[model samples]
Target: MAELIVQARWLVTGVQDRHTPIGIDDGAVLSRDGTIVATGLLDEMKRLAPTATVKTYPDHVMLPGFVNSHHHVGMTPLQLGSPDYALELWFAGRMPARRIDLYLDTLYSAFEMIASGVTTVQHIHGWMPGGYDAIHGAATKVLDAYRSIGMRASYCYAVREQNRLVYEDDETFCAKLPSPLGEELSAYLKAQAMPFSDFLKLFDQLTAENQGQRLTRIQLAPANLHWCSDESLVALHEKATAANVPMHMHLLETAYQKEYARRRTGKTAVRHLHDLGVLSPRMTLGHSVWMTQEDVDIAAQTGTCICHNCSSNFRLRSGIAPLNAFEKKGMTVGMGLDEAGINDDRDMLQELRLVLRAHRVPGMDDDDVPSCPQVLKMATESGAKTTAFGETIGKLEAGRGFDAVLLNWKTATYPFQDPDIPMLDAVMQRAKTNAVDAVFIDGEVVYADGRFTNIDRDAVLNEIADVLAKPRTPDEISRRNLGRAVFPHVKAFYDGYIGDGPVQPFYRQSSSV
Candidate 1:
């Protein structure tokens, strides 16, 4: 019912035609009823929302609020000691050692995210079924919290069809275990798991609730890395296609995964998915860090989006994603934090900087891996597109959703006299989470001046601490034992396999663009 008129010193209306600041003074954006009405010179916008409550901030870069394409937002507790191992062992060990609750943890993570200038997040809610109901309820609470805060999110209630504790015949288990960890270990794990159909039914229930509440929507992710059968993958793809929603999963993340797919299907992971008819623009893959050049080509051809988990990749020693190669192939690559990071922070700016720097080809370096603008797109536009939110929220265009963040340039971006340098570079190199002065989603300020208006930060943290202190689930306990056995083996396997290969780093030959 109320209109908001904001006049900033500079506005980076993320429209491609007008990405740079239009003016140094008197630039404004008008929004009413949670939608942007106009954006232009301050004089023009003021006339559009003449009677509106006006808010102004000078000397800031008003750009679109970042969208984190892939993250386990609620998995904060697990990421605490994350830098110690690779991904498989990390998941195996940490899932058991950590306590996860969808409700409180989600809120705490969301609060952290929003405060750090992330307006939208795609959360991978990988919860086991023993506590399914509680997880669902907690997720619902999280969605409600997001709505109240005016944040956008795409949630994935991760569907893992394999249950480790429920054992099945050696033959069946062997068939599923991607070759290396075969029938022998399969006996230790479960084969008779919940059917994919059951997960679909659960998806239906969740979607029904979504329709009822007008809350945040979730995509259907069939776990990752050839974990689901062909039939299950096909079914899930079709369901997502029919429902007109996005589907996501981890892909080609580790050497073992690539090896597993190669041994089982005689193709790489992305290729295997393409053959299964699951490759499409609608599907967003996470941590495509191990993709080959051919895989990059395939992703380009199929228009499958990828979330580059830079922090997680480096932290787990997963190796740098072929980001430079992917760009050359013209594939869509977005930035992701993936549960752990430089500071366990959800700030995409930090992730972007890491992505830009880490992938540089060593020794023959010339600044070629990625430019600041490229990394910015990975965090903003590209990330939004992966979650099917790009059409509206990625940019701060006049007609698009007014989702933007304000950076306090005085503190974070000092000595800012040059307009020749792209604001993207300044934001990436100099800005910190504390520099995020305010954030607006759907045309309204949700967070500003170092405080959150949606939820109680202290209370959320207390609740998370309480929930995380609870006892582990039975499945988690089993996973812990399995991890203790498998970690040493995994470490040895990796050590033996990837033993001292020539490190090929990316470097920019020229700044043509």
Candidate 2:
């Protein structure tokens, strides 16, 4: 690629160092071969690289591209005909949706994410039906789509050894179901089951194959606490450690998961992971909504990151996470749109605004609430730590990849533009998908002016729609109906077996108050 100079009216570089300011008005970035060479005032950049090709955005605000720290197949469960049931039930209900080609399914969400200013995503793959060969093919298709679309992704197929859906063992749960449902579920489980050794082998194969890819990396995901056996979890940790790759897992996403941890291990989920020697700086816990104070302490001590999925928590009735508490403890926190945002789309700017406001408690003091700069860091720098691209894609600096989004200033700050007001704050509060005029990954423009440069958006959308229009298979219909039948028992298992434990407040009052 040719050297380029990108100048904007205002720039938010996402640099959080104590010595530098976060926003630079009338700034420019000079880049070559996907790496930023300099970022400073436009005049200084012009003086430094006089011959570079110049692209001026007089009506735009540029910043580091948003990183989606945790996600699962791009399609929302609700869009797949699964109502907003609790997490467990929603998993079952999503089985009936017509399956599309993995490439299209992955790209469908990629378009939403990129159009909304997200350039990187940690895609946690789950729920593939076939064994090793089928899953390997699916993984290749998903990664190929990301590579073809010019997006950065950390891909991991979630590993589950024992409990597939609920807290109980698969065979035991199947025994409770009546004839055809039980038989169907049993066969499904049998078809999907692969040895733990095979999963590790597949991880090694994928890592070897994608070692030097520009836009994709392979990682490990243990799925969840209830899903993986102790042996499998240990093996996964060892493999990831040996390979020096990061690990991301779902922990305490719901109250039921917390209860399951308590009943099974006689300790909290975080404590269990700590005891198992899996908690480390390389691990990121997704949707830690129900963590106790002790759990937070353990996480901080171990340097484990927490990814907050604000919208999905509300949609699934998973209670609000104490984000303020996590920040107060000096833990590294990242933001994620687990499946979709409040608008049922992957809009990161809106998700950032939601995260900024959701943790504000009843207080007149400003010190306790999240600041605009802090929330922006979570969406960019801190969020990048949770993925494979630890420090490479989050900031606009001398040595980092040129991943960024340019928001149209007219749409983001209209009717109330004041020079004195903080531009980052205004953009965070008012920005929407419509304002995202251009997006860049690896110093190349992938999306600009409402269209993707790498792929034909209309053709891809038409293909997805055509695939979904097909009638559901008989097996899929049976699975959907069976999921409804089993939903009550799943609820009863939690209610009768676990009961209600201590209730923790969503927001904790400051000690001074």
Candidate 3:
């Protein structure tokens, strides 16, 4: 491939340097063979790569592509009418979604993410009831979609030995329900069950099958604390350690989860994981909204990463995460749009702004707030750490892949173009999906001028619509009805268990007034 030089009016390098600003005025990046060769002023880059083909964007700002650290099922749940219920109840409504073509489903969200400037995603695959063959096919289709879209993805099938749906065991939960519903749920759980050993074997199979894929890598997830038994957790840790791959799990995402940890292990989820010997730098805990200061300390000491899903927390009424505290503890916190953002879309730019404002704790002290640079890093470099890519794809430097997004300055930096205003702040606050002009991954332009180069966006959406237009099967209809019926019991169980009034918000205290 020929050398490529991309010049923009402004560039945000997303480099990890506290003393220096991330933006560079009149910046350019030079790349060849899918790797960036240099980043510097336009004239300097031109001098370095004198004969390279140049692409100039006089009215755009380039930044490292965003990474979504935790995601699952793409747009399946939302497209099928699952509202933003609490995590536990949401699963019930989501269970009935008609199985559409996995490739189209994955690409639907990939389009939204790429249009919103995201280049990497951590896809936590779960809830495939057809067992190993079904899951393997779905995983392969999802990976194919990502490859066709030219986006990097870290894929992991979530492993759960118990508590498939509700917090209680299947027998206990079924026993509490009426006769046929109980029988139906029990049978469903039985059908869905896969042994812990089988899941590990499947993981090894996938790793070997996709060993040299350019844009996709395999990882592991134990699902969550309550979902996995102690033996399963230890086994997962050992397997991941032996394989030298990252492990991500859902931990303390909701108040009930915190209580479950207390009831099940007599300790916090973080402490239990530490005891299980899984809280390492390779482990990333998703939606850590309800963790205490001590849990944060343990996470920091163990070099674990946290993926903060700001919109999912707010939409599901999962309290705000103590992101400020996490930062204070020097923990690596990455931003993620778990299911979708506040706008019910995977818009990373808006997600960034939401994260920047979410942690402002009504204090006049500027130190109490998250800066633009801090949030930018969370979306880029820090987020990359949560995926299998690690430090390879987050920054713009020599030897790093050219993964980036170009924002149209006309919309991103409009009305307030004062030179004194920080460019990064302006982009974060004002940029929207419409402002995204182009996106690149591994030195290739995947999306440009509202069109995807690798895949036919319109054709894929049309196919998905045609598939979804079909009537739901009898089994699917029954699942939907039963899920709705079971939701009340699930809610009541949690309500009775967490009877201590209301859980306080992370930043609020009872004596503050």
Candidate 4:
């Protein structure tokens, strides 16, 4: 049977040269066999698909589903109301104390994303131990969760090392550890020890394995700035060159990270990555909010993408990204809410609006620059391109995957000066997460009205509660066993935070099992 959906108003495509609306009224989309076969006026579509079942979305605004280019999906619940501190302090306090389970981990973040109308996301699974076994099991569960819920995803295995004790001066940390323990940790942390020769190898594996799946694509994300080295970064570049997989990484979002990169490499963070030869068309740098002009030029030249997380950057006081400048340079930028904090809200529309308003740099006005629809383009189509699914998804055209969002406009309708302006402006500024009336991926309606077709919402919520309520893992217990030693560092970290607020008081305590 043919499935048809008609909307009174919809963006049939992006705006044309004058940035004026190219969308049509009484727009309709027809699909069969999980593809958009036709899209035009209601009567035309009806004539095209005679005897087909039709669903009229009279007051709903239809648009391409939002794709969140950067996220850490399962890390949401553990760090709620965390101390409004720097990134280092947040990760230090938060990661060590919390425990996570598969079901809860999947449900908490997955539902949050779906609720926010983020049908596609790239979740960098970096928290677990960097070993084959540690990664596959937990990651599989998360992938299964996403698949079950009908969310599209680009799942990345973070390849790099982590320092357990950030407080110990580098020399002291190296010298004080028993040589054997140091060796073991060293081996574990060494980028040379990881599987997958390069980014391309990983991409080749993904394309090889995912023969039929349309919603999920695999990606390559180097763990973090500190975890990867010059050699490892080059390996990544080689892989990117070989397979053409999109490379995403956390970069210069934190002050300490900025300082560390400068002090260690004698260059800015983005410049250092460029020096390592990792800047290219396959690169999607997460949180390039702290980049310099030189860095922006490098990004533009190399055709690198920026996944802008407006709320997360400001919430953590990482400063606003130069969206206006990036757009002027013809660089493609996508909107994102980095996992946790105020970023936890999956509503990408709010994030998109914030991106437009937050970075107005002292001298620019609205008309002098891009419009809200351009930013929405970043959120929807550009986001899909930021990951491995660059060409496979995004726009709602024939032969592309049927990933789309149907928004409810009746609740938030307002008078507009020009009907020619795209619907994105309303969706960005006026609509809320609840306004997402329905979402579809691969022509299957995953979320409709207010419920998930593939998952039990309450059951998922309860699972997250259960996992968080469980006792911390053995490794966590060992870290807690070192609580006395860790406390001094934790205290010092909180004490030196720039904002003059009560540190621990800002955060809600984790509930004991």
Q: TM-scores of all models?
A: 0.85, 0.96, 0.96, 0.84
lDDT per residue for candidate 4 within 193-309, as digits (tens), equals: 445453345445555766687777777887667766677778777766776677788887765666667767899988888887788878888887667788889899989898888
Alpha-carbon runs more than 4 Å astray in model 3 = 17-20, 501-505, 509-513
Q: lDDT winner between 1 and 2, please give it.
A: 2
- As for model 3, its CA RMSD to the true structure in angstroms is 1.8
TM-score of 3: 0.96
Off by over 4 Å in 1: 15-26, 75-83, 131-135, 163-193, 212-215, 362-367, 415-420, 466-513
Tens digits of per-residue lDDT for model 3, 1-513: 678899899888875642244767889999997789999988888898889888999999899999999888666467788888888888776767787778888998999999999999999987778877887888899999999889999999999878878888989989989988888888888888888877888888889988778899999999999899988888888888899899999999998899999999899999988987888999999999899888989999999999999999999888888998888877888988988889888889989999998888886886777888888889889999999889888888778879999999888766667778777777778888989999989888999999999999999888988887889888889888877878787777677777566554668533645
Clashing pairs in 3: none
Please give the CA lDDT of all the candidate structures: 0.70, 0.87, 0.87, 0.68
lDDT value, residue 46 of candidate 2: 82
Off by over 4 Å in 4: 1-8, 15-21, 75-81, 162-208, 341-343, 367-370, 414-423, 470-484, 487-513
Q: Give the higher-TM-score candidate: 1 or 2.
A: 2
Give the worst 10-residue stretch by lDDT in candidate 2.
14-23
Note the clash tally of each candidate: 7, 0, 0, 2
Q: What lDDT tens digits, residue by residue, belong to model 2 across residues 16-89?
A: 63123377788899998889999998878888788888888999999999999998776777788878888877
